[model samples]
Target: MSLTSPAPPGGGPLRLRDFRLLLAGAAAGQAGAQIALVALPLVAVLVLDASAFQVGLLTAAETAAFLLIGLPAGAWTDRARKLPLMIRADAVRALAMASVPVAGAAGVLTMAQLYVVALVTGTATVFFDVAHQSFLPHLLRTEHLVAGNGALETVRSSAQVAGPGVGGGLVQLLGAQLAIVADAIGYALSALFLLGIRVTEERPEPVPGASLRKDVAEGLRFVAGHPLLRVIAAATGLANFFAAMLMATQTVFLVRVLGLRPAALGLVLSAAAVGGLAGALCAGALGRRFGQARVIRLSALVSAPFGLLWPLSYGGAGAVLFAVGSGAVFFGAVVYNVAQVSLRQALCPPRLLGRMNATLRFVMWGTLPLGALAGGALADALGSRAALVCCAAGLLLFPLPLLLSPLRRLRDLPATATAVTAVTAATEDPGRAGGTPGTPGTSGAPVGTEAP
Candidate 1:
């Protein structure tokens, strides 16, 4: 696909210059972060002799950052210059991550320090993510959002497949502290790349009597009232919740039950990651050929059933079989996710993008902790295989909300644009103090009327 392609059927053209730089920066930064995700806890355990509970606490801290800052950060992004916010977030992550190496060099690495680093990096990441997605429309036209989002999925898939192996090797060779240096560098480089991009957006002129709280509330009200958005949120939340359960249980099942080595586990996950990339690459083509909604539904239908195959393969060579199954599941997940993201982005007005994005992510990821907790408890009580089986069953059935909603009956992206517009238009000025869109004689205010 040409990065500078013309406006798609319903929207504006792709901003090749800005999108490419942002893509590069995002890819590099994500790769670095994924690598550290594995290395950090290992560093705490091996270098500092931290307990298992401490390691769990570290994970909790990171997730808590998402839960705490996601919505507010989204609100903040909507109200600010997204690019500068993104740049600052990257800089903060870079500095915070660099401290890992500094502490290690001084022979003073501690569990507390690791948790702090994770918290800071994760919080910065929350802000960067909200800003980045919100900023995309300003750079690219409406039509190109699908392809642009596809390109991003490609980067994320590649990172997922490669980052872990690279991180493990780096930790072995350079030590965990020095290994983190790469992440710090990646963040700095990402910021530098973003600095080179230039794009201007129309800003809301403040009403002499405007209220910031009112502006934030407008975003909240928008999210709460949209039907399609609500459906999307429910479907995604269910999917993420079940997926987290499987992930939490997989390692133990592989090592203890399946008797796979760490290397084998890595290999299986890598295969899945590559499969995820393949699925993402196919999303645009699939949407074009089969129609977006159809493809999404079909993928969702198949993903969970196949995901079950992993736990069933519990003997010798179970590792390889589980890996293959994982790859299939990942592929299906990519198809579903890319289509969903494109749909949501296409539907939302640019002004409300940050809060909408944040609210969606917060709700979707919010279930992760519950899933993790359940997985742990189930594994201890019923065994790891049973826990995974439960996850697979949940996944197979999780798409009920979307399937039952108007989503199943829909076909192309264009068909849903009206619903998106109405929903977004209703929230444009939350301060209207009246009925909503689709109400008798109620017309949405002009787009871009809401203060970011």
Candidate 2:
């Protein structure tokens, strides 16, 4: 298939064979990931008898690669074909996950092994995610980007809706060790599906005298210099920081503080994901109705207050408060993510797609490890409920960056980076003439949009 050609107009990217394959692979991979999200911590808590801080350390390990290799991964991804890189990532993740079950069967499973697997898989994910986002523009037209992203998010959300339930059931029926086997199988299936994509991409043309450091710096400059991107990055980074705290401590809180079993815990998570699913379903329409830029701020403003419900949750019917709060927060996050990510993809230049994504991810996701450590340490120092209170307060503060930025005044984001820069220049110096704005760049669209 030709890389320059667009999918047939009508029915979105779903009608394309290659897109279908990609979506199928995403479905497989996301389902497994959701399962591991539940089973991994369960293994640490249930089998290894990990303490609160140890569980936080485990969560930090899973995301530390983003801080360590995030920038260079983007440079490498831009230098290689994305499909093969994604396949290799899936293979690595599958193998890593498979080792857990094998080691458990051999009576040698330990926190050390889990940490190694988390680090290895997290490194692979950095590459896979950068490549996946960079590859989409080659497969579909600019107009299809939002729809394509929405479709992928829909499958992911659906998996979140069901995968945790299945994982919990598996944990109850089979041991947590054996339950992880499902994640390995899912990655294997994802790899197989990726192999079926027939689209061929030419190798990226290397820049003359290019060094990795310079390339990485260029990506950083592009994001940092952009007025809108800076605000979006700040908001997202703060949100992820607090979200990471929640991730690191939520299992410990639910399992110990609330006294929930594995099965009940999964159901609560699944229930919370319903909001993400709804947000995915409504994102495209919301963007159309409320302008994407406006929606971004509105989503955050609406969701911030709901976070207080988490620390207030208690046993029995009051537990529903936690689920509702989480659901409301997730809904806002998904909507905010879909709008901002699509805007980012639209604005970036073709050659800089990989670097732009990588830079943004580094800025946004790099805080995860720090947040995890803080959550773990805080939980150990204070009680788990106290830690939850801190995270909830942090969540309320996440929207401050957006509310204070130019996004608050704009209805829709400009379609191109050139336009954004031009507008900024015009606003700063009213006497000078800025160039005419350009249309949205058709370089690439985002896939695997950030999870909250």
Candidate 3:
């Protein structure tokens, strides 16, 4: 049964109490996530004295869930209650994070433990993120997705800005083992906030004759049959691939090639995060002005060139140049994300949201582990500076998939239920004669195959 909910009275989500709680939970969770992102590696490197290979392995573990269970997890979420599932995932992550500090204090914490914690938390995160995205459409209307996403993105960016500094300081003051306690505490707080939400969620209806394999196929078809989604998936996948390469090598590069300490690295990341915040803040306005689809295309054009600058940093003041390049890259990427994600929420049917998001994540983020491993191998073979140059060049091509798609020609996109329904129909219906070339209103697809 659908909740007898009225359309939220005001434009912004802040007017809704339940939305506020949801945002708060996300804020707390992301803050903890950012802290852990920095703290976990610090513990591995500084405390346990892990090697570059170990750190690369740890990085691969962090995103391995995307490849392992990213597909079926969406089907599971589609059947389960999103709010309760998210809450439980948070609790699981909290326990995992807390265990790290306990083992560290006992002087038994090992690099093995760090990898386990990363994997555990990462698995939990995959579920939380998919459920969270699925839950938002229920909480807000399609129109508010940009505003809602922007607000949430701002919180996320702020968390990243503050979290690194906070994580670094805690590591400095207390041991890395103790610093991780803060991440555990943050997850606990997120659960508490989620518990405070009053909105009632209707249980998901089970798909008749649904097997995991069949359900996963449904999602894959949903994305692959459409042009815009397929292109977006490819673009994001490329970005993740190169970004993972950077992730696999950046820490080692910063520490060895640039000779920077952890604290300085934290400040640099914080500086880059400020650009993300600014991009989030500007997303809605940019969407309204340039058209959402145009913003996405333009964002790639603006951001990809700056990636070339990252390979040029020398040392000392060059770190400032590095931050500037990274910050600009982040700026364009965040703006692109805000527009594209909002478009998707508006595009997908409610029943398919979980699976759609999961499929997209699987397609886009599944590349991370591969990229991470490739980056590590590249560094081992070619050295960090050369690896950085190669990855930076790779980043320049991330926008190609989108540039060659119908999305590049669009001025706006369809977000109404009728339009999305039509688009879904075009994908599933075989007799539509290739479905009007995937342009908006041309048989309801953003892109599709040419007819004979």
* The best candidate in terms of lDDT: 2
User: How many residue pairs clash per model?
Assistant: 2, 0, 2
> For model 2, where is the 10-residue window of minimal lDDT?
443-452
Residues 1-452, model 3: lDDT tens digits: 15445348666778888889988998998898888777787788788776666777888988999999999999999988898999999999999999998997787888888888888988998999999999888888666777888999989988978887788777777867888888998899999999998877789777678888987888888788765688889999999998888788777777678877777777777777787888888988888887777888889888877766667876787887677777788888889998888776766667777888999999998999889888888887888788889898999898887777766546666533344345445555636434432333212323232221
As for lDDT, the candidate ahead, 1 or 2, is 2
**On residues 352-419, what C-alpha lDDT tens digit does candidate 1 reach at each position?**
78878888878887677567667767777788788888888888877787777645544554343344
TM-score of 2: 0.93
What is the per-residue lDDT of model 2 for residues 1-452, given as tens digits with 9 covering 90 to 100? 13644588887798899999999999999999999999999999999999889999999999999899999988888888889999999999999999999999999999999999999999999988888888886687778888888888888888988888888888988979999999999999999999999877778888999989988987888788778888898999999999999999999998898888888888888888898899999999998888777899999999878989989998767778888999899889888888887777776766777888999889899999889999999999997889989999999888899887756656677654445655566656655644443333333322222211
Residue 29, candidate 2: alpha-carbon lDDT = 96
In order, candidate lDDTs are 0.71, 0.86, 0.80
lDDT assessment of candidate 1: 0.71
Between candidates 1 and 3, the one scoring higher on TM-score is 3
Tell me the lDDT of candidate 3.
Answer: 0.80
lDDT of 2: 0.86
Ranking by TM-score: 2, 3, 1
Better of 1 and 3 by lDDT: 3
